[model samples]
Target: MDSLKKKEQTLKSSCTTSQFCFFCTMKEPDSPQRRAGLANCFKQMPLTDDQENVLVSSGLFHIAMAQPDDPEFPSLGIFECMASLIQKGVNDEMWLRRDQNIYIPYYAAHIIGSYTMNKVEFAEKAVESGVIPPLMELLRGNKMSWVEQRVAVRALGHLASYERTFEALSTYEEEVVRLAMDLASTCVDVVYDNFVGVKDTRRRAKYQCDLLTRGVGGFEMENCKAEEWTSQLQCWSLYLLNCFAYKERSLNLICEEGFLRNLCGMWGGLANHVSPAGVGLIRILCYSKYGRKKVAELNEVVESLCNLSRSSDDWQYMGIDCLLLLLKDTDTRYKVIDIAFFFLVDLVEIKDLGDRSNFGEAIIKVLLLDYHKQNKVKLINISSSKARKAVEDLWDWNVERRRKERAMSDEKLEERRVLVGLIKQQASRLYCLGEIEEATRKYSEALALCPLSLRKERMVLYSNRARCRLLLEDPSSAIRDSTRALCLSTPANSHRKSLWRRSQAYDMKGLAKESLMDCIMFIKYGCIKSDQDQTATKPRSGVKIPYYAARMISKQMDATWLFATARSRIKESDNQCGNDEGQYYREEIMMRKMMDNRGLSTIREEPLVVKEDINRRKVERARRISKRATSQIGLPHDVGVAEIQCGGPTKRDRYSKFSSSDFISF
Candidate 1:
């Protein structure tokens, strides 16, 4: 006891500041006496105007709590030190007047956030220490800096993870909901404003600048710093919304307050950070029946989502989910089916359906549910044998010939051609709907019955058949059919559909030379197929279609070349270019080098040496692109489309109506 007393005296004599005293005192041996001594020391320390000293003391308290089992440590005392920092930071009139020591509350928030992590018991104790009020206060508008606001909301998010803190947060539910809505509205406004007057050269220029530097909101370059702060605030705000979205009360409040409207309005154009969280929130709320109805009632919402699903790959899954849920309602099924069926068919063709192959099942449900809604005669039940028979009869080769025989004149040949056209149309629909085998059979039947006079129609059948064969994994047959269609074409570029399909077939068969040539021709011809129905929908009206088409062709072309080059480099590094494979590969590589092109979504991983070589080539390509872009457009060129900048939740102006009362001061 005498030696311990001497050690304590020596530690106290060496302490130069309250921060040092706080740590030196905590370093004592474990005992009830030590806990009492630490508490008394904290209480005796004068309130230093030095924000760093108080912040450091809070840091020491957090460290002490790291070992909860230490008998000398007291969780309650540590929380008190953190709470004291909060009280001093907020209540200190001089610091508040000068705004000099705001980091005190910021660090206090960090301590509270860290203490609550994976420790539910500490959360309950911290709540009892009046930590919630200060954390909540920091989230209020005009109460703290952007960084501080983000830290506070993040701390609350951690606290809200615990059942106790979540309940405590619910007590202040109205303010929290309002804040979340405000942040959501800001994000929505940013995206919507991006499309406003987009045709105006100035707005388009500003939009581009915003995407690159996030400075378009004020048209000043320095606002880029504000952009980061805004992005962080928006992220955490969505997080807070996700935390609050689980309960029925919060769900109702969110829906009642226009969160759905903002979410739907921005679905077409959300920033990278906000899109995932926004979609997640929509998915969560749509899980409820009332939420589903609210969404279904908003025709514009449905329209935006359908448009988004068609254009953006990022939101397709969630868009499909929300569509499926809305389709469950009998009254809305037909309307949704009309808008969604086309893209859903497209999605079914490319994406792995996994268990959600019920996409087809859902269509079946919609057909059944809306059987009486249409004024026309209801079609045969999709599942019944009669429907199967009708489908078979429609595609049967003999049935069309029999109908033609009844004409008994030269007109009968024309009738045969008409019957062939009908069969081809049905086959095209089946192929798009992902019934590949059946569509192939129908296409063959149509071709067999087609008269020589219907030469154009025959070419289309061959092209359609080629697509089915490609999807069905018969590359050789697909190539043959596509080649046949190309040979019988009406004009130079009129066979683009056949050409592109043949390219895909060549790619599948590892015939990269043939594929690259076809892709180049497709791009040369505006990238749209001759068949009107087969063309991809334009993302926006009045935008040139060829630009996007060229972009896609470029991407696929690069993908093919990368695969070919990497394989050749690995297998035939020193081979002469006289061979069929080597000649084509060498020419294409030369073409790429001259154009200084780089690939997106390359075909396969390369060996380390090949990978390094490709990377060096890519860097050189990018440099060339940058220089060319500057010369031509005067703006930095991004290969991908630039996203719009949405202000994050921390934008001060959005929540400026709320005063300091909204934040916790105690």
Candidate 2:
């Protein structure tokens, strides 16, 4: 200590006594002469270790603190000198014996790393000058101290930032990526082995931290267990992996080796910094289907994504981007929906409309695919607002999608209108000409070109097509088309027309019951009391009286056929004596309609109670008649009548429609 102090004191005095010393050269006045002097002094040939040691001990590292471009500073030759010292210090055997010697290169690498940050050309020069090999050596473990590793990692990160240095680092990309995967895989294995009882993630994370930070020994050991320290190393490794993610070869190797699962595992223990890089890497990898399948297979990957999505706003979108890709797979989509539903709900609630729109699609897909219709109702019942909004937004989005697909500008809309009008006219002309096939084709063409929202035109088109279909003897298709027309038509006249056409279709389909129902509905809504009434109320536009009369008579004949068929079917069922409730109800309805149409009262003459009483009296009368006939060996019919006549004075007899109370009379 005393010898070094005396040497430093003497060195200061010598520097003060002479203006031609290294210190004076370093801090020379601003002039062309001084610039040349400083440059010449700094321009020394390849430095030896002995000279570097002497200069470092004499405070040579301070000179490197200023950048090379400082007005009075020396040339960039200082970087060469510092880089040489770093290279020698890491490579020398004796240099590791003293703690102070390690820092000489550590600080030098810092300066070099910082200086090369903004200068790609300079970084390339440094790479060519071989600064990467020494920095890489520090990163590789030959039992370097944490402090040494820290600076080394940082320096490498800075160098790797530039394209040129990044390329230089690519030589070691395989080793670095594998190293990270091994650490992460080790962490996953540890957790998996103890996974049964390790339910608390934070506790598990602490255990990982302890295992890493404290090692198996203790913190005081040379290579203390610093999970945080290891995490720093992994961050740089992941940085390299992130760059490699864009390269197809490296990415496939990373995935094929099962490195991505370990990457996902890092989320629980090292999320704050590692997650963003890991997520970005996975996002890039998922651009291909196989990579997405691999990522989706990893355990707790969805959980990690949910954690990231909940961590911050920026991660939320990035996480969802990855999720959308993963969701393309069926199993992964269900898992994501199952585990992350509430988190996604929260995201949708807080995000702006744009993000919510995407979230809506995801939610709808999950609900549509994973849940059955019954389960969907239950899910909605649980979170009505979220489910409802999701459905509504999805519908609105679908509508907008269709709208955009049509690209319906004003010009296009006008052209479609003109085309639709001409097509419909041509179809109508063909229909009147009895060319049913040609008319059907023209109507279908018009429908294909028509806008989806034009309900009235679509209804007319569907109705016209159904007429053509009916002419073609395709009753099923005609029924479908007419039913659609009825659903779309709002006006009473259109409803009546649609109902009549549909009834005709059902009759042609041999569905007497359905035809009857349509006829009833048509009368119910159209209020057509009779064929004469329908004609009187019908709109008389462009119709000759003969055509109107013929049309009305045709509709009246169809109505008569439908009613007679329904009534005969009901009567046949009633006579079968099979207790058919449907037929009984149909009969009662028909009776009511018949009475109402004839302007007659709907009330029945015999009260229900009186009818029951009359039935009992008739049974008693039959029994008495049998007894009278059996009592007298050959009793005359007149004698049985006399007994009934004697009993006819009873009050029940006057209530009966017939004077006699026998079963036949009643």
Candidate 3:
């Protein structure tokens, strides 16, 4: 200790006497001189993984963290170095140790993104220098880690943002789209397993009190920053897809099955709740007729939009924007109204959103005109006047509660509030232990002791009891509790748990329409992000809209036909209950108008192709098969058959005479 202290005491004197300081070199701003120094630092080559990673990861991390606004690094060949480094790190397993080399890919891609963020010229140069392929590798998981994918998507987002390089990005569109979809869908759980939990404390402990703080922060700062990065990683992946979606580059891949449902549940909005996360990508997807049709076909997406439309978040207009686009064209309007109508009718009288003054009225007008006469959502007396008052109160958040005050003072109310929280916690533990009866009785006792002014607490108690009722096979009691909980909540039916419980109860009673309505309402409530929780990065209050709730809605939507009742009415009039009567309801001429108006005539619906397109492809394949059969058997090319002619030798017999390799396409 004495020897080390003497060495440290003279360290500055040694530097001064030697006429050079390494600390000064590291402190200098990004310049050609500084960058040149870094390049030389790696020239003494063939260092061990431990030694080399110190230089590589440290240099890349700083450069990535302090990225200049003026594009200093990319102009100095730093971008090319980072690109080369990512390629090297991905290929070499020897140096890619868990503690060291794993950071190379992350920092390398972050450097590219930080540089290309402000300038289009830099992104253009990056594409010219071959950055997309290596970045795409990180996205595709050459290492199979979400850590690399986080920065990889960020870099590609910058690359795709430029007009000069989007063509290059679209070159690998299908794979990139598929990989990004999987990442967006599963990255959260992937990160939670590997980086979170109690057993992984050592893995996370290495990063504590480090880079997250540029200096002055404390109290679990490492975990908080990791969480922020995870959120950004998820949102950035969506941002990359948003670039493709907004440009309408790969609508076929963006609107693929199950992704829309995944997109709806991605509630990790922007860091400060500045923008709702997946809702923006979905809104961009709705710009085209093809996207609109595909988005409308899914009940989950529409109901989520219906829910998000009521949000007090900054992006509230996006939800209304998507629903309006879906309802704009008459061809896609009929069947979607039943899912959107009741959910949206609550917003009909809300003239609150500043972006669009008359959106409420406009929504009703669009539904009526495009919904047609026989198959329409009648807007007359939609929500009750009491529900309208709740919605009005929702907008005017400053308005005080109108309930008659109890005799208790503020001191007694505070004591009661604390007591309710304790009781609820006890109930939660009992519920987790499967003590449904005890939990229900505890929640009821809490409800009795709670003050009337404590609406939020009382509502939670009622919702909890509703869950107990559902578990006890008491559907009627569940319905009453859920309804009371709904009434207690502001903005009418925004309580997700109660709505889900009520939907299940209604399903038990065979009330299909009511169950489906509550199902949509349930999703809509989950989509409502608030500006209040932005700083804390907290999730929504209730449990997520249940999976069984979503399944119930999808099942109900399948049985729903907008004109089923009207078709039966027609059969009764004509006494002709034939299948042909089903096709005569309305001749939709808007498909051509939709194609021309949206300019999507060039984009084919490969994922959800029309029936005629399917039949045409089938016929083309059939002709090719017949032509092959003609060549094999001496039959004429004029005959067309899906299966070979009976007179010709069977496929097995012909293949037996010739080598199997002779007909590889077959």
Candidate number of the best TM-score: 3
Residue 456 error for model 1, in Å?
Answer: 24
Per-candidate Cα RMSD to the true structure, in Å, reads 20.6, 33.2, 25.2
Off by over 4 Å in 1: 1-15, 23-51, 54-76, 97-100, 187-229, 250-252, 256-258, 265-275, 311-315, 331-335, 350-666
- Give the winner by TM-score: 1 or 3: 3
Query: TM-score of each candidate?
Result: 0.48, 0.42, 0.52
Question: In terms of lDDT, which candidate is strongest?
Answer: 3
Candidate 2's clash total is 6
lDDT string, candidate 2, 395-507, tens digits: 44445546774787878777887899899999876654445678889999998777766768877888788766765667666766665565455532235556556665666
Expressed as tens digits, the lDDT of each residue in 72-127 for candidate 3 is 54665666666776887788776665445555666678778887887888888888
Per residue, candidate 1 scores C-alpha lDDT tens digits across 1-666 of 233234435554575555435556556687665676677655543254542344344445446347433433235365666667666666675774442244456556766666676678777877887777777676774545445566677667777777777898888888887776676556323422332212233644332333334233332222232333444556667677877775655766777635676665332111122345556677666777766766766766675565434322344567767776776665555445555544343332121232344343453344344343332244332334444343343323223544555555777777888899899888755544445678889999998887644657878888878876765668767866775565456542247777667666666665543455565556434322332234456432111222223333444544433222223334443433333443344333333332232121111111111111121122233334334444554432111101001001111311345343222110
For candidate 3, give the lDDT of residue 430.
58
Q: How many clashing residue pairs are found in candidate 3?
A: 1
Task: Arrange candidates, best TM-score first.
Answer: 3, 1, 2
lDDT, each prediction: 0.52, 0.50, 0.59
Clashes of each: 4, 6, 1
